[model samples]
Target: MSPLRPEELQALLHAAVDDLRPAPDGYERIRAGIDRRRRWRVPAYAAGGAVLAALAALAFFAISPRSHTEVVEPASPVTGQLGSGALAPTASRTASPPVIGPALSPSLSSKGGPTGATATGSATPSTPAPAGSPTVTPTRRAENSSPATVAKDGDIDGDGVVDPDISYNGTALVVTLSHNHQTRAVTLAGVVTPLHYTVTDLDDDGRGEILVEVSGAGGVTTYDVVRLQPDGSLRALSKGPLPLVVGASSSSGAGFSCSGGLVQVRSGTSDDGTTYQVTTTSWRLSGVTFAPVGKATTTSYDTTSSAADPFTARCGTL
Candidate 1:
């Protein structure tokens, strides 16, 4: 027989141990020894495993840059893309380009100096100002240097008959018409009270209206405008009074000269040798009532020949 290997010897010893009885004193001692050894070996093996695991963890941390510490940042809308706030550069970060439509080039300066493009690139053509440059806005000249000239007709009341006493008072033009054995007075007002006026259909309204210059009374000699109503009434339609002026003297003459819608009241002595007192008053007709509007006092002294001229005679109103 050849010499037995270590395996044969170990198998023979295991068979002998297996054949031993459990109640034997030697068996009990051997079992206690095996249990003690197993307890010690288990603790040693567990300690060794713990040390190995610790070493592996240390190696992992050393090898990887971001292994030990984790950094949490705000999540971005795009998947897997880092936000600008997360990886900002040390040098203070700036706002990102706006994600709008196509980017536009910088606008060219409209200053008087040459443009940057002309200096660097080709010269650009410039449009010249047109010859006799058209006026951006044209101004309109005033209608007439003075107010429109109104035509005068003797028939002021539209009756087609001339009345000698009908006239304009600068504020109102009055025409006295005799109809059906009763005298009826008609007056018309105008925007401007002319120095002299003649009756004409100003607005083509068939009815006659008077044009008179409205003037202020005392120190601040300013003129305004007014119109005459068809019923022989005075109406002030402007910011100031009519252009009628009153003389200082007490004895003055007053008379009315009418042409169409235009009427003028002259209250003063003519070229004849006479002194007269003229009291001219204005009133507005409200229904049947005549309301006092304004009053003026004028006196006229005739230094010429003493001939009794009806043209220069004093007149009155009832």
Candidate 2:
């Protein structure tokens, strides 16, 4: 372990410097590689930023709520009418109420006029008007005595006798009895035109019932049934629209017929603009009202394509 002098240390350092070597293009090559890497990284970062922005916009729209509007309609009243003499109320006579005495039971007077009947079912016979003293007349009799046009005859009150007669007063249809001379006015509550009328003793009682055919706007047809009361008022037999056959489309129509005291209704409508459906329903009298007794059938046929569908369905025992 001998220590060298200062001159020896200086010569050793000079020798280490002479042993080192340098590459010619070291700095220039490093600078060119860094520039190439930066060019590729800039495009990749730009593309990544664009993708993130698009995802944010799509999520915003997906979570937003949409707006909607709805429409509502008012409830309609129930009323109906029947056209032609075909519609009738046909129930068994067993359903009829007991035979109350005729609605207008009057005793005969000397002049063949009405003799007042008492509340106790007793009649007080009237003699001639005291030998026509002064010949006084009633003003009410003159004003309301415009002879009514008898439209039909029926036992509107179900009183075992068809003593009620229908007539057309200037304002409405009037039902009157000959004995009491009381009048009942009939009107279609929600209907527009009372087009036609007919009467039939469907119940086989001595009294008849009235069926009126009415037409509303948009070619809507309906039927109404009215019963005359002994108390001088008319009552609706059908409290609502009695659907014989309801039209569902502009080109559709309904028809009804009666046979053997049974009513048959036939209707047709286009179901989806491509298929047409026809329905038939049969009804019978139950007690004071009509009920669907037999089977109802609906048959559908395709109109757009050939022979793809001609289906039939039994709508249960309606």
Q: For each candidate, what is the lDDT?
A: 0.32, 0.41
Query: By TM-score, how accurate is candidate 2?
Result: 0.36
Question: Which candidate leads the pack in lDDT?
Answer: 2
In angstroms, the error of model 1 at 219 is: 14
Which stretches of model 2 miss by more than 4 angstroms?
A: 1-172, 178-181, 190-195, 229-233, 239-251, 271-276, 298-318
Report the Cα lDDT for candidate 1.
Answer: 0.32
Residue-level lDDT of model 1, residues 109-158, one tens digit each, is: 11111111110111111223334322121111121211222211222233
**Clash counts for all predictions:** 32, 8
Number of the top TM-score candidate = 2
Cα-based TM-score, every candidate: 0.19, 0.36
- Tell me how far the alpha carbon of residue 87 in candidate 2 is from the true structure, in angstroms, after superposition: 21
Name the lDDT value of residue 273 in candidate 2.
58
